[model samples]
Target: MSMDAVTLPDLSGRTAIVTGANSGLGVETTRMLAGMGARVVMAVRDVDKGREAADAVRGETEVRWLDLADLASVRAFAKEWKGDLHLLINNAGVMAIPESRTKDGFETQFGTNHLGHFALTNLLLEHVTGRVVTVSSSLHRRAPGIEFDNVDLVGRYTPYRAYNQSKLANLLFTLELQRRLADAGSPVLAVAAHPGYAATNLQSHSGSRVQRALLAVGNRVFAQNATAGALPTIYAATQDVPGAAYAGPKNMGGQRGAPALAGRSEAAWNSVAAHRLWALSEELTGVTFPLTSSTG
Candidate 1:
């Protein structure tokens, strides 16, 4: 199925917040939601870049500062949000990168791509009663799983492996979030999606020059443009999707096509891992999501 063939539903009176909205898939997602009459918030790390992207969009949208590398920034952004949020797209992430740490002292890729968003999502859980979209990746299948002993990737950090771990964490987070929401009978739906080799600036983080060159070539040969790549995320965020559904392009190897239900790794479906991750996430982020027994 071609991405262009899919039709988006009207989003009147809806409110959406898209992280990393300054460019690439995030910009396109914001544009589409705004075009459908949704009030969109471009949650960005840089205000200037965000304004430029927001100005390019054809519908109503606003920009807000949100640095996923900084826990304080995530908390501040959540506190400043004032109304009900129909969609929360955790779209921002770091790709392959050299070993580094966020201001919050987490490894760069895992921190920004997983833990930071985890904190942000929990902090804003009160406002997001409709849907939450976590952008994962096909690369999630590369890593063994979450390294519970060394989440920060302390002494053994290979760029791709670290990124793979983060993406796996994303899927784990989504599934666990859905379970908790269901258990509590909350109105919020948790889903996961991937762009499936979208041509974006995310590769700039690669630590190796050779890896970056390889990525560039791969993108040129196979990657879809940002707009086409954003469909799955939009589908997860806006469609009448079932809880815990995973969306991605329905194409060869799940790349460059319309969004549809996609497959997840066996480990991603582990309830025990999800539960453990959830508990750890709550402890690490210092944010407790209220779960009631009535719905479980």
Candidate 2:
């Protein structure tokens, strides 16, 4: 369907949690979902910034503090969450940045963009019934695949490479989540989306000055605005699609255009990798999802 032709379904009784809701595409996705009658929880690191963004939306929404870089914060938020959750948008992430580690000593990009969301999803699995949307990126194709030995990328750390690895992890998570859910006979859907080249502050953290400058200029010339970028995510969360579907703009080289079904990497469909990632994720986070070998 065309971008303008798409319409959100009614969500009067739905409750949604959107990470990174304080700005950019996350903010717009929360705004549109709330506008459609869903009660949104703005999961952000900055309460003040989240409040400001929430206040701008027309419908009711709450702000909750969550730091994806800190596992403690993630646990607290998950423990505090009550009632059935219709959606969980893993929209919070960091882009290219200088080598660093999370509070738990994981590589920064992999920690914040992959492990954090992995932990959060496991924590909230019981409460989630409808859909889980993971915000990945086209850059996922850049990485070779998961580095089983050096998942932390301790010795070999390049900003872009790490970022790509994290995005690939997102796809692995989505596909594995769907597989597990299907095995369990659960109704919850797991989907992924990329915003294409949207103008957002995510690039502000880039380690390369040249890359940052180019991003800034490209945002003005080539990138679409945040609202347009968020359409794929919104569609993934609300659409009546089957589990494991991926959404993105139908543009040249997947750059920019109307939102539609996008193809994932061949490796993303590997069930072995998916299962391996799931086991490693559980081990790393110390949070095991209630998954059986055969969910169905």
Candidate 3:
């Protein structure tokens, strides 16, 4: 379907929180959600930038600080949130970059993309009444599987591989979250979406100047802007999609078209991997899911 802001239903009474709402797909997602009457909270690592971006959005919107690389920040955001949350869009993410560690001492991409969101989701599961939408990437297909032996990759770390692992983890996390919710007889839906080749600051972290320049040209020629790229996320959050469903662009290798159900790598659908990742996430983040009867 050609889902857009005009097609999205009025969300006047609903409340949503979007992580990394300062730029890229996060900006557009927040704009549409807020414009559609949802009380949208822009959770960002930079309060100043988040406020600046929030100014560009209409409807009831607020800015909150949330550093996905920091578990304390996630907990703080959850503690401050008082009312029921209808939507939690896990949109903020870091792409390929130099190997580093988050404040919590995990690999940066894996920490922020998978574990951080995992912790945040479990923390806020009690207040999320409607759904959770996690942003993944088509690059997930490149991942062999979850590396249970060595998550950080240690001496084997590479930019693309680490990113691929994190993206795959995003899908695995979504599938597992939905499975657990269903098993517990909960109504909350867990879905995943990928913004295919979108022109955003997501690439600003790339360490290769040559690659960045080439990508800039490619983005101008082949990539969609954040506005169009955000459709899949908007669709996943608003549509009555089934749990574990994946959404992405419906054309050009999932890059440029209306939002629709998208395919996943064989490894992505592995329930065993999903379960293992879920267990590891719980062990690492120290946050538990199915917080309550009403929110889980």
**Please, what is the whole-model Cα lDDT of each candidate in the order they appear?**
0.88, 0.91, 0.91
The sequence of per-residue lDDT tens digits that candidate 2 reaches over residues 11-48 is 89999999999999999999889988999999999999
- Stretches off by above 4 angstroms in model 3 are 1-6, 291-296
**Model 1 steric clash pairs:** none
- Per-candidate total of colliding backbone pairs: 0, 3, 0
lDDT of 3 at 257: 78
Predicted structure 3: lDDT: 0.91
Give the winner by lDDT: 1 or 2.
2
**Any residue pairs clashing in model 3, and if so which?**
none
Please give the RMSD of candidate 2 to the true structure.
Answer: 1.6
Give the alpha carbon lDDT tens digit for every residue of 71-128 in model 3.
Answer: 9998998888899999999999999999999999999999999999998898888788
At residue 262, candidate 1 shows an lDDT of 93
Per-residue lDDT of model 1, residues 81-152, tens digit only: 898999999999988888889997888889899888899888888788689999999989887778888888
TM-score of 2: 0.97
